[model samples]
Target: MEIRKATEKDVREITTIYNEGIEDRIATLETEVKTDKYVMEWLFQREKRYLVIVMEENSHIVGWASINPYSHRCAYRGVGELSIYIKREYRGKGLGQNLLLALEKNGQQNEFYKFVLFTFSFNDLGQGLYRKMGYRKVGVFEKQGIRDGEHVDVMIMEKLLG
Candidate 1:
């Protein structure tokens, strides 16, 4: 497998993997599936400090990760919010770990000092991957988001690149 920076051409696969995560209802709070145009706009609108990466095998993108602005405030410029998604068939095969590593590396190169992510409290697999990657649990937000007509707790995790 090869891990590298993501480009516009990879949007289709990225969208597929992201939709899979949304459909699984474990990786993200977003319920609506993303369209290619939406994803493209999201990708191109990011500042230079924000980075997106993808993991591919045999010419197919299996997973993707991105670092986004944690906040618009200047004081939080060094902090980045994290997003990661692996195709359902690729989950638990260590692809997420590799993707995150690449994302962190690129983040650091772009001057990011810390990375934070939010995951559903019951997402044991995702939590395990984050913990194994040296991210620490900050805390849980009770009823943070609504998924499937029910409120679900969200856990925040962070890692300092320094």
Candidate 2:
């Protein structure tokens, strides 16, 4: 398996992997399946300093991670929000860890001082992975939002790069 920077050509496969996460209902609150065109447009507007990486095996994308703006204010310029998703079949194989490590290193190199992410409270696997990766649970937002007609709590995790 090879982990490399993602390009426009990889957006379709990335969208597939992301949609899998969306369908699982455990990874994200988003219910609508994303389209390649929509993903491509988002990718195009990504902050130039941040990084987007993909894990590929046999020329097929199996996972992806990205660091995006945490906020628009210049005071928050050193912070970024992280997102990672691996194809369901590829979970528990350290792919998420590897992808996150890459994103963290790349983000730090690009002057980001912090990386933050949110996970559903019930997603033990994801929380465990983030903890293993050195991310600390900053807080939990109770009844953060409603998804699929159920209220869900979200755990906020953060890692300082300094």
Please provide, for model 2 over 1-162, each residue's C-alpha lDDT reduced to its tens digit, 9 standing for 90 to 100: 899999999999999999999898988889999999999988888768867899999999999999988999999999999999999899988899989988888887899999999999999998999999889999999999888999999999999986
lDDT for 104 (candidate 1): 84
lDDT of each: 0.89, 0.91
Candidate 2 colliding pairs: none
RMSD in angstroms between candidate 1 and the native structure over all alpha carbons: 0.9
lDDT of 1: 0.89
- Prediction RMSDs, each to the true structure: 0.9, 0.9
Question: For candidate 1, lDDT tens digit of each residue in 93-162?
Answer: 8888888888888888888899999998888999999999999999999998799999999999999996
Highest lDDT against the true fold, candidate: 2
